[model samples]
Target: MLEPLGVDATCELVYREMLTHPGEGVAALAQRLGLSREDVGIALDQLSSLALVRQSYEPSGRQRPVSPEVAMRILLERQSAELEAHQHRLALSRAAATQLIAEASEAMADPQQVGVELLVGIDRIREWLSQLATEIQGEVLTFAPDGAQTQDNMDASRPLNLGLLQRGVRLRTIYLESIRSDAPTLDHVRSLIRSGAEVRTAPLLPTRMIIADRRLAMLPVDDHDSGRGAVVFSESPTVQALHALFESVWERARVVGGAPPSSKDADLAPQDAAALKLLAEGHTVESIAKRLGVSPRTARRITTSLQDRLGARGRFEAGVKAVRRGWLPMRD
Candidate 1:
């Protein structure tokens, strides 16, 4: 405790001796603690500065140990205030750093070469995305392919997503149909939606991509191996083409969290209805399993159960029966 208060061993010894012998003179404390008089004097000076010891009024040169409670309270309060001051400084530093990075990005970005830039690693890609998010001034469009919205992915994205939304950015995300049955992913999506994001789902997506402000787009260099890094497009033609593809998919995608109009759909659980829709879309069991974040066996089980419930002879027949019964929506 004394160490944290900047009390050295010699000072602590003198303080302890003073505690035992109240109003002890410097020479008396020095002799009692087996320390030289000069050492005791130095310790007294240190303790006095910390409010741990003070000169007695009755004997001007004699020292009295202050109450431990009072001394500790003063030290703790001072430390707390210093900590708060450091926190304020940290906040200002962060603001300054953000401003500097924004200025650097503007300086490095060239109008002639804005169309395409190669991001070489995951760290770099994340940095660029963070920078882009900070600079974004308009709507955000995202397309998430099957098996992409894991809990880890959502966790990593939450901060960036919330930051943009808090700044009044409009976010629209598209996910595969199978995610409707994924509890964790669906929960994350619901949270985003509640925070003013627009979410939709389709049986398939062209690729995983994010288009910000209709001016910039990012997609994996290799869809099968995202570790290959990403390609960012700021060029007009590429961005426009990606935007058009997103719009086409958006038009065909169903709005998540919407009410099921048909009585048959209303009677079934949402996940069950979603599975039926994927089946109608002709997604294979393995593909559905990946999309739903479940094993293929579970996907087959769901398909079999749906077939039995619809009184259909096979998976294809089940799809037809489900459509006729208004349990599955027909594709456009």
Candidate 2:
């Protein structure tokens, strides 16, 4: 425990030996502790600096151990004062950083220069997103395509999303309907909703995009291969168009928790509905099974059930009938 106060084991041993053999010289203490004379001399220097040991004029200028109670109190007081001073400096640094960031953002806000930056690799995208989330001033709009998010993705996103929410930034998100039955993703969505975010689901989404404060937007450079890289758009017109596309889709999407179950959709469970929506999106039975975490046989059975319920001949007709009956919300 004394190590935290810069007291090493050797120093403690030397001090203990000095305590028992009061007014002992460093050589005598070294012999009692079975340590080298050089080691004992170093320990003596440290203990003296900490006021844990001192050279006594009596007894031929030998060393004497100070009372630990007094020594420890002085060390703690010094530590506390240093900690407070460091904290004060840290706060000032943070304030300066915030001002510098604001100035940099302003400098980069030129309309003539298209702020289209290419971020290569997932690591770069994640890093940029983290920094962008912290600087978001008004709102964050996201179009999350694909199926249910992986646990790793959700874990990575939680801190950034929650930080933005805590800062009073409005969060509006649109997710693919296929993820509606995803337990982990659904749980994460519910938590965000509780934190004042508006979340919705649709049968299909155009692409994965994130727009922050209506000023900047980011989308994968190649939608088919997101790992390739992503493009960041700061041009006002392009960002506005992306924002509009999100709003249009958001208008038609069903609210995750607030939308009341339609009487037509009530006949099917949430997972069943999600499966049907995925099927309607041209997803194969194997892919559907994978997304739903079920067997291929179970996925085929679900399709059969939808076909029977809609009185359709096949998968395509079933999809058409489901759309007509308003049982599934399909993106045009």
Candidate 3:
């Protein structure tokens, strides 16, 4: 067993070596441990580093010696209570999955039926999503309001989404604007798009959601934690209505490159707008002066106008406000 003390293999060999060669040379200890001389030398070196082994040299030999018990103690140290906490966590997860499976989430009567299933933990929620992805014969709607970018998120979703897409299930996903900069997340998402899941995004969103076949829905119980939160899957009318609301929002979102607006335009402006457009392109005063064919004084005046109009203190803030005000197009 893996232990805080370490593992069984290293412990037993070291124990036997200590007993057989309490004060023998390192080479003799290596033979007893069935390891290479270098390996035994290193292990003993480590023991001495910990002060469990003391070094001494015979007439012509140099090596440290150790007691058998010290080697065994190092090899067989007990794992901490922290590991027991992990075991407890595993038990809790299994219990949650089992509870819903036994109850069948109101789907046993009709495994393919339109119904509501209440899942109380994150694992159960992801488990249901995976199952629906496997069973869905038609469409899957996904609205990931929270940025799920962890190992558990991938573990619960990657295969499920891929399998559904591969089988020709129509998949739709909506992302928040903030998700664009996460390189790993985008790579995974791009792969899904290539696999046939249509993707879209918007500026701000709330809660994570998935609706399977327009009949069963799953959404977060809370946003702070993926695991501590709850999931609701229901064929219940109230649940379905809420799902439709999400769908309505999803439909209104722009698909990837559905319509990328024009970049900062010279035509869209007052001097402030024109100035911000120039600033976004990395223009300095001299550059803006040259571009607009204006004097340095005139360029600085334009910059001041832009910042004040946007209620900003600097050129960068003005550029930000310009984008927010639709003076520049947004891309993810």
Output the number of the TM-score-best candidate.
2
For model 3, how does the per-residue alpha-carbon lDDT over 1-332 read when each residue is reduced to its tens digit? 22223333553465346655566776777776678878776666555554445655666444444565664444322222323343456568867976775565334334355444456675676666666666889988877765435566765678888888889889988875435656767777788888888888754344567777877767654444566544455667856786777777776555664665345434444334545666655568985654443457877887777777677665545544565567754322
Poorly placed runs, candidate 2 (over 4 Å): 1-113, 264-283, 286-299, 310-332
Deviation of model 1 at 289, angstroms: 3.0
Q: Write the per-residue lDDT of candidate 1 for residues 1-332, one digit (tens) a residue.
A: 35544467888888888878887687787778888889988888888888888777784667788887887666555544544465466568867976874564454344456566767677888889889988998899998885437677788899999999999999999987767777888899999999999999875566779999998989876555667677788857979999999999898677988854457445775546667766755567986676554679988988889988998775556665665567755433
Q: What stretches of model 3 exceed 4 Å from their correct place?
A: 1-116, 262-309, 312-332
TM-scores, all candidates, are 0.51, 0.54, 0.45
lDDT of 1 at 130: 82
By TM-score, highest first, what's the ranking? 2, 1, 3
- Candidate 1: give the clashing pairs: 115-235
Native-to-model Cα distance after best TM-score fit, residue 10 in candidate 3, in Å: 91
Give candidate 1 regions above 4 Å deviation.
Answer: 1-114, 261-284, 291-294, 302-332
Q: What TM-score does structure 1 among the candidates reach?
A: 0.51
Candidate 3 C-alpha error for residue 257, in Å:
4.4
Report clashes for each candidate as comma-separated counts: 1, 0, 7
State in Å the error of residue 45, model 1.
Answer: 99
**Candidates by lDDT, descending order:** 2, 1, 3
List CA RMSD, all candidates: 24.7, 25.0, 24.7
